[model samples]
Target: MSGIILLLQFIAAVIMLPLHILNFLGFWDAIIKKLFPLFYNKLCETYNKSMDEHKRGIFSNISDFSGPSKELRLLEVGCGTGANFKFYPSGCKVTCLDINPNFQKFLSKSQAKNDHLIYERFLLASVDNMTSVADGSMDVVVCTLLACSVPNIPAILKEIQRVLRPGGAFYFIEHVASTDESSWTGFFQKVLNPSWSLIFDRCSLRKTTWKDLENAKFSELNLRHITAPTSVKLIGPHIIGYAVK
Candidate 1:
């Protein structure tokens, strides 16, 4: 009887391991989502000047402020907690998309706070397959710190291109692989990638995202690399720019 009880206990432990792991990942992700807004807001305070410099003319040709509907449309891909809402020009209808449903609550909070911006919709979908959004619909598509986690960067860029009207812009700020992969920083990023992905939901530290974006179907691409704050050495070097369709 004791042997049978022990056997059952071991079986239960085996069965619970994966479930526990999933739960932990969910819990960690939720905590990050909740705390990220505060962190990001502070980061912006410190880096706003640089960020604004990079984002110059990103909203050029987008017009109509003051609650006017259907004039200017902006779509944010992987808009975690809607952190970018404050940067948008007022009265533009904004659509947000994310794979993590957990961020919906945060996005709602952000939308409520930024009442000047009109909320079009929130779609719980990956950027690679945003079929729910009509083609050639958005005037601007924005992404920040997003491409690292996507499984197919090129596919997402293609989808962005497809959804953008001619002369529309896709603005992005992403951490990319080191310029020289043989550098010590690159070696560290490679070694730390597995653990980083496990903690941060598959965010790769060594993705050659800038090169991929350059190769995407864009009429013109302008990009520049900037050194991020030293605190984020794990994902520090960043590329910021826009690609025009």
Candidate 2:
């Protein structure tokens, strides 16, 4: 029994040795972050019009939003490379929070390109612990393609709820686990999840995003499932909606 356990441990170590080396070198994370924006930005460029329309529908209901007198205070969690900068209303104050500081350069570029948005501040913090931001301060909180990768979804949602003012909007777009777990794409997602998570800064292939949002502390959740154009089976099915705090 002792020999068998030792042998199993040895095999596991052998299999994980290369992966450990890659992780240590930060090879996969660096490459994916560098290349992901190129393809994803193209997809966003094509689909942004529809997304913008949907976002507008959400904003239309909010009574006290950005106007000539007041600038809406917006917090964007995990604002990777600032892909959604263009979708924001002009002159709204935008605060960006992200775990990885490397994206700061890209964010600066995005801010420069989209002069309409007032880039307020950048916080280097995890989504789950946004203590730097005061409670009930933000009028709007936005997160895109973020839920699938967070370490603790519930904790992050809680933070979001805490920071948002009463009746503030929490806009989110996230990839989620499929209802039919046995489907081809689902199967691939399950198979690739471990490797994918290891490579991409703990981004999970499976997430019950809709259910998670429903279970959150939000007063209202208006979410819709949609098939994203990205052919990647791991993250093809997406949800877009807003929760009222």
Candidate 3:
């Protein structure tokens, strides 16, 4: 079985080599920026529809604002097309952040549609390095489908810990690497990772993001792993939870 899997992976890698070369030549960068928002927004809709129950359970904490004021100050890292805005509770003052500036227009459309929550300024910056946001300023920090792509997961988590208020919560929903190496899914993730990253804005299919969250040492953590209901089998494995700082 192992030998067969390896052979299949090798053949798949060979088939993907040309696309990888195009990615290396920056052929996909401009195209991705132009199309990714639309693609991601559609994916978000599918996930939201399929995983509504799980998402509601995980995001329930955001509604429990124990702050002195009624309004909750929220920051979303990698806030692609503002897909999560609909899930946010009312009276939330949301500040969006993303590496891609192209998403701003789509994000604006999403914001306009979800008018229940207040929209703060959107910052064009990377999640790993958010120097503009002050320490202990955010009441809640949310990230979804982002951990897989970041260049440095630890750095991004560290910055998340830094920006959250003492008791503020960090909520996340991320697809992760399959844990079972003997499984075909895991084998494919390993073999296709290089091309996957090149084509998808450096998003790795093999990151164990849950482990990084565990190592971050949040005061309280509640995490669960599940399979996302998506046709893309490679990205089905996911982790969803929150960590209180």
Candidate 4:
């Protein structure tokens, strides 16, 4: 059993090494921003079903806010290429935002015509400072695998609180600190985060934590870690959770 585990670990590391290098160099962002549609289309194809389900599930508890209020407002911060999108019920509109404005074309071209589409035409905004979006302007905020890269997570949370209408919801599925507090996983995460952040350009598993959400003034919060088998050196730790405001 020990031998098998060691062998698996070796194989995983080999695979992730290259990806980590790319992340560190910030190559991924340069590539994605310049060629947005490719990123956009891939997400629509791959994540449509699972993401839709994820979104629907997140909204289950917060569905009460969906009634008419000048076109039901939904804000998806860190929206990337509209990837893995789900069809929210009509009357509930979704406004997507991301670091890269290049992704907007995907929504404009692919999103349902009825969508109230607010695609960052107004101004550039970051999670830390949501000057563009008004306070209490939204019914829901969805963030997917985002926040891990945010430089000022506290500010982002504050912004989320400010923009979200009273009783609104914030849903997310982020990679977080490992559930196993043991040394094996702990050491790897410490080693892996620096490398992963560089390769992915903005991701460091360390930054996405339960404490970040706990501090956000949310009345209700739910958190869970997700794990997947390693195809590479870095694997076996992720957290998926949702928070309700």
Candidate 5:
């Protein structure tokens, strides 16, 4: 009986594991954006004390550079299904650009009839070349969880700098590679990265780090590190805080 139960548990984990990786990597956004909101709504609404506390700390750290969003034209590169749309104030004009067709459904679903959200738009494009956005047009550039998977970080940063109005800010939330610890995250990254890339199509955990941000053409920046236990840490090694340009 115990053996049977263990076998069933193992089977379930195997099945769910791929779905989770797909979701985390934003590959499933095509289906997940429309379907998973029912699940994500509950999760984000209820909030986990530990994750929220950490997010709050990290978000607050970024908020210092946010200035005021009320009248700003905000651009979000790689807005996966517009998850952070609900997180931002309604007064700001929010624009999202991503190459994922998956998020299009979510974009349509977010009608924003009664919501406080204002001027929310999604563009399907790459950050490496945002020619559609006029030069020095945006007041703020926000990237959440998307920078980790951005393929052309250097070019994207250049585009960001080109589009952002002088004195505009760049804000991001990303899972950074570890500089301190080498236990759970480093170990799992070394082991699972190959498989993760295979299944997720193109996502790398160990590729992104603070160095990417620091190397970008941004000034007046601050960075902070947020760590977690084995479970979350296995997926997210380090959370980065960036407030620059």
Candidate 6:
């Protein structure tokens, strides 16, 4: 089994060598920026159906704010293509943030499609360092399908906590590593992780992101694991829930 795994990894590495070179040259980022949204949108169509109930339950809290005069402030870190815009409660003043400026055009189109929510602005910033956003300013913080790709999960979570107001919620949905290492999916994830990350913008299939969330010291944490509805078996394991600050 070990020998077979080594052979698979070697073959995958050789196959992905060109992509690694393109990534190192910074050309892959440009290509992914243009193409990823289209691919992600199709993925979300199926993914959203599977998580509709969970998303509705999580986003329901947005309507709990009292008074009609107060504006509901929301910040979505790594808000690629504004995929969660439809799930948001009406009248939300949403600030979208992403490290890639190329996503702005796609996000704008999504914002237009979901006209009920107020589009605040798009910030081209890394999730780990969001110094531009004021401390404790957001009523809610959201992230979906993003934690896998970030260089530092803990740093990003810290920033999410920092920018949220007292009693504010941080909602997240992230694919995680399979706990059962004996499983074939887990074996492939471990074997192909290096090549996969190289091809897909540093998205690690083996990150135990749920563990990081637990250690983040949120006042209240409500989390659950689920199998994401995707044909890709490597990213099937997922954690979906929210934590309150």
Best by lDDT: 3
Assess every candidate by TM-score.
0.76, 0.80, 0.92, 0.71, 0.72, 0.92
**Per-residue accuracy of model 3 over 84-158 as CA lDDT, tens digit each:** 888899879999999899888889999999999998889999998999999999999999999898878999999
> lDDT per residue, candidate 1, 157-220, as tens digits?
9999999888788888888888767676676676656555644666889888988987888998
Q: In model 6, state the lDDT of residue 14.
A: 87
**True lDDT of residue 92, candidate 4:** 55
Candidate 1: where are CA atoms >4 Å away? 1-70
Model 1 lDDT vs. the true structure? 0.76
Using TM-score as the yardstick, the better of models 3 and 5 is 3
Give the TM-score (vs. native) of candidate 5: 0.72
lDDT of 4 by residue, 1-245 (tens): 44654565566556677765665587766774566456436744654454455546555654566535545577878776555244455445666677666666665665645353433332345767778788988888877667777888788888888988887777776656666645576556665565455545557766646678877789988876656333322444555556667
Q: Which sections of candidate 3 miss by over 4 Å?
A: 1-10
lDDT of 2 by residue, 121-229 (tens): 9999999999999998898999987888887888899999999888788998888877687687776666566666765567787888788899998888889887766
Give the Cα error of residue 122 in candidate 5, in Å: 1.9
Cα lDDT tens digits, model 5, 1-245, are 44654565456557668776776787775754455445433433343333555555544532333335437678888765555665555466777788766656665555354266566567879888888999988878877666656677778788888988777877766666666445655655655554454444456667655777778768766677666433455555555465556
- Predicted structure 5: lDDT: 0.63
Pitting candidate 2 against candidate 5, the one with the higher TM-score is 2
Off by over 4 Å in 2: 1-17, 24-69
Task: Give the least accurate 10-residue stretch of model 3, judged by summed lDDT.
Answer: 61-70
Whichever of 1 and 4 has more lDDT, that candidate is 1
Model 1 pairs whose backbones collide: none
When sorted by lDDT, best at the front, the candidate numbers are 3, 6, 2, 1, 4, 5
- Model 1 TM-score is 0.76
Give the range of the ten consecutive residues with the poorest summed lDDT in model 1. 61-70
